[model samples]
Target: MSATGVQQVVAEMLQPYLDQEGFELVDVEYVKEGGNRYLRVYVDKEGGIDIDECGRISEYLSDRLDDKDPIPDAYILEVSSPGAERPLKKPEDFRRAVGKDVYITTYEPIGGKKEFEGRLLSYDENELTLNSGKKTDVIPTDKVAGARLAIIF
Candidate 1:
């Protein structure tokens, strides 16, 4: 099957288990890098996730994949936490991220540039308010190409 199809299938198969286990499904990614294919599943919970948790999820998923035989090719399976810099794909993610540091890239320039990194003040379906140092930028949600939680050093 196609890569997107594989992602959908795996996500469908994993959701029930995750929900029952008190885990949240963050995202599923299928990609080819360094001449190898990888299916990466990002998961999280109320506090966070640890290596042992990832291993347990991985072990369970490995068995399911073996039974379903969904991929149709040789690929490595990786399950882990999304980390502190988790991508904000849904509107809910943006909404929950208010008052947190975030890095955002727009499809086109918002204020003479495409990148904005600062504190997210507020978020709604129409737009999001951000404060970057001395400036506050109001960004249209539709214009965002990518967004992620950021750790400022």
Candidate 2:
């Protein structure tokens, strides 16, 4: 199956289990690294996710995947937490990230720049307020091509 198709199938199959366990499905990746194919599921919760939680989720999904046999070829199935620098793929992610450092990229220039890395001051339905050094930048949410938690030192 295609990479996107694989991710979708895995997400659909595992979402119910994750929800029941108070886990959030952050992202799913099906990629080729060197000669091997890998299927990785990134999960998270309020405080964070631990190794034991990841193991349980992995086992549950493994059983389900084995029963359904969704993938035609061999691949690795991994379940783990989305770490500190997790991608903010949804509005809720941005909301949770308020008062935290972030790195965001836009599809096109906003205020003559496509990149914004700073403290995410706030997030409304339509926009985000970022304190980028000495200046504050207001960026439209729709223009964001990518966003992730960042560490600035």
Candidate 3:
């Protein structure tokens, strides 16, 4: 199966378990690294997730993947927490991140710049307003190439 296909299958399979555990499914990736293929699942919860939680999620997903047999080749299954700089993948993520510092890169330049680092002032469905110094930038979500929480000193 294709990488995206595998991710979708895994996400569907893991949703119930995550919901029951009060964990949020951050993201999932099926990718090749060197000679090995890996299925990585990033999960999060209210505070943070511990090693024990990761282990349990791994064990559960491993068994489910084995039974379903989605992938044709031998692959590593990994379940873990999205760390301090977790990715903002969904609109909800952006919404929740309002008032926090963030780093964002656009697919194309906005105001002749593709990268933005500042405090997130607001986030609507289509755009994000960021405050950088004395200026505020309105960035369209479609233009975002990458975005993550910024570590403030």
State which candidate has the highest lDDT.
2
lDDT of each: 0.93, 0.95, 0.92
Off by over 4 Å in 2: none
Instruction: Write model 3 residue lDDT over 7-107, tens digit each, in one string.
Output: 89999999999999899999999999999998899999989999999999999999988898888989888888989988999988998899999999999
Poorly placed runs, candidate 1 (over 4 Å): none
Predicted candidate 1 versus true structure: per-residue lDDT over 1-153, tens digit per residue: 888999899999999999999998899999999989999999999899999999999998999999989888899999999999998988888888999999999999987989999999999999999898889999999999999999988
State how far residue 130 of model 3 sits from its true place (Å). 0.7
Please list all clashing residue pairs in model 1, or write none if there are none.
none
lDDT of 2 by residue, 110-148 (tens): 989999999999999899999978899999999999999
Q: How many residue pairs of model 3 clash at the backbone?
A: 0
**Candidate 2 lDDT for residue 46:** 91
TM-score of 1: 0.96
Cα shift from native, residue 54, model 3 (Å): 0.5
Give the per-residue Cα lDDT of candidate 2 at 90: 85
In Å, residue 84's CA in model 3 sits off its true spot by 0.5
